[model samples]
Target chain A: MKKDMRSGFFALIGKAAGIVAVGAGLGLGVNALRADGLSLGATRPTVGDDKSTAGSCSAGPTTNVPEASIDEARALYGKPGVTFVDARSRADFERGHVKGAVLLPYEAAAAAAGQASLPVPTDHRLIVYCEYVNCQLSSLLAQLLSQSGCERVRVLKGGYPAWASAGLPTGTGP
Target chain B: MGERRAANGDGAVSESAATSGVSSSCAVTRFLEGPIVQIAARLALAAIFFYAAIPKIGDPAAFARDIANYRLVPEEMVSPAAVMLPWIELVTALCLALGVLTRGAALVCAVLLAAFTAATTAAVLRGLNIECGCFGQSGSGNAVGWGTVVRDAAFLVPAVLVVLFDRGRYGLAKAIKRP
Candidate 1:
């Protein structure tokens, strides 16, 4: 009886291993065939640098977008040619945002890419931000804006929360 | 005549009473180990995994971003995990729902649930205000919190039960094995 139980346990483990192997194989195979598949070795774009891993497998033209520190953004604040673009949801924007920041939520901007005019002036330097550093919406929006022919685009390093925490100027409204 | 003699024999009544008690308990155990309970557990887990897999499969890039937000995986490995995890969930779901390799799929589901629980718990402790990314990138409302940790932990019960007690009854595995 003990032998039978031991064998049963081994058989179950073997089956589980087989399932994982098959699943991984199918996943890699399918991803390879898809157009939008990501390259496995690619690194996320780092702050303050234009060096970014080719994001997708297709290896399209890469964009050179940098991230700006809070101080740098503070320096640029209220400048004639600089604009702060909030990439968070409309609700988040309404709750609070960087003073003078224009609300352009990431999802809406992505959907309207190539068709709609972005809220910022074409010639203005743009600084994009979402909730925090880990949030990707700001980076994604910055990329979209750069791809849409915005000359100078930068993601805010720590995002709106970081700016607000640093005692920077802020506002709350639609 | 012989049976009556046995019933009336010394200790026979006590033996019968003991036998009745054992059988009643056995019946409850048998019902729990039966096909009905096993099938329900298997199907419920299957539905959840299937629902979670679909959106991630459709948008792996966004899914990768979500995974990166967790900050658990190294940046380079994030893409591969994001690409493969949805497929694994999908395959396991299909197997569980179809009653094919039911035990194996249940084991995978249990492991996945454990990992998710751990990730969410870590996020909560660290106070990272981010989406759970349990379903997909658009899981905007599924924030990582103690509630998310509890939900993933709760899912493990059915998954582990299916792994241990599933006997392949009413499953494709049995049919496929038949010559």
Candidate 2:
């Protein structure tokens, strides 16, 4: 008989050994990862956030607007006492911003909770804005504001670029 | 007569050498190509991860409560970690299925499963009876027990398979062939 016939027995043994070795190796690896994840137990929460956990999603007095249309924000633009906050990076705010708009980046609000500069008062009607459609920081900021228990929090109808593109009042901020 | 004898010897030697070479190479090739056994293993793992997370994602706070119950995290971060954990699981799972970054993805998954298994083992030995909250609290909480460890170990099998035979049934590389 050809040696190939005997090869089958060796292949079977090889596969069985492969399976066991693989399982044991991964088992050890899982032990290590679990140890690490446990070590990281509290650290996971300190990382990325601002939504879902911000405020109670339902029955939590949230002024959450999943999405805002540009036209809707524009209509709200001139409303008295409505604060249009540009919830974008500082660079975008400096390059140009919506007229009467203020810069309050999302990270800043969360990072500096007690600072006076953040417009995070319980009484203020806050509107966080970002670039435009599909951008998330504005929504995220709005969510944070809601979680922090602001009286009213909303993202701008359209983000900053949308307002600028519409030829609305824009350019520099105090 | 001498020439005929010499030719016969050469022919036999070549035949034996070729047979052994083919036998060795086929086993290696099967491993490289990701035989059906490995494919089944990967698919099994993908299904487990993708579905295990649906309930948790739907109602994250419940999962947060579970995390909090672990008494492991600080008061502040509990909620945020609750929201992000499911997303990480979902993304890693999709990556495993796509076979993109197979090694890294498998390693991460192995890590995750191992973590779960450790928790399961810990719960079992420590006599701390609590809901694993792995799939979420569907309504009533189930007690943590040996079943959870077994379930997690069952899941661990495929992660090991992937790590050992990473080329996969449908991967981007093959073994070096000899002439």
| Residue A126 alpha-carbon offset, candidate 2, angstroms | 40
Please give me the total number of clashing residue pairs in predicted model 1.
Answer: 0
Docking class for candidate 1 = acceptable
The deviation in Å at residue B150 for candidate 1 is: 0.9
> Candidate 1: which stretches are off by over 4 Å?
A46-81, A86-126, A131-133, A137-174, B1-25, B137-139
Model 1 chain A: which ten-residue window has the lowest total lDDT?
Answer: A51-60
Mind giving the per-residue lDDT tens digits that candidate 1 earns over B89-127? 999999998999889889999999999999999989988
lDDT of 2 at B54: 66
Best by TM-score: 1
In the range A74-155, model 2's lDDT, one tens digit per residue, is 7777687666778776776877787777787766765664343354334545567776343456766776666555646676
TM-score for every candidate vs. truth?
Answer: 0.72, 0.41
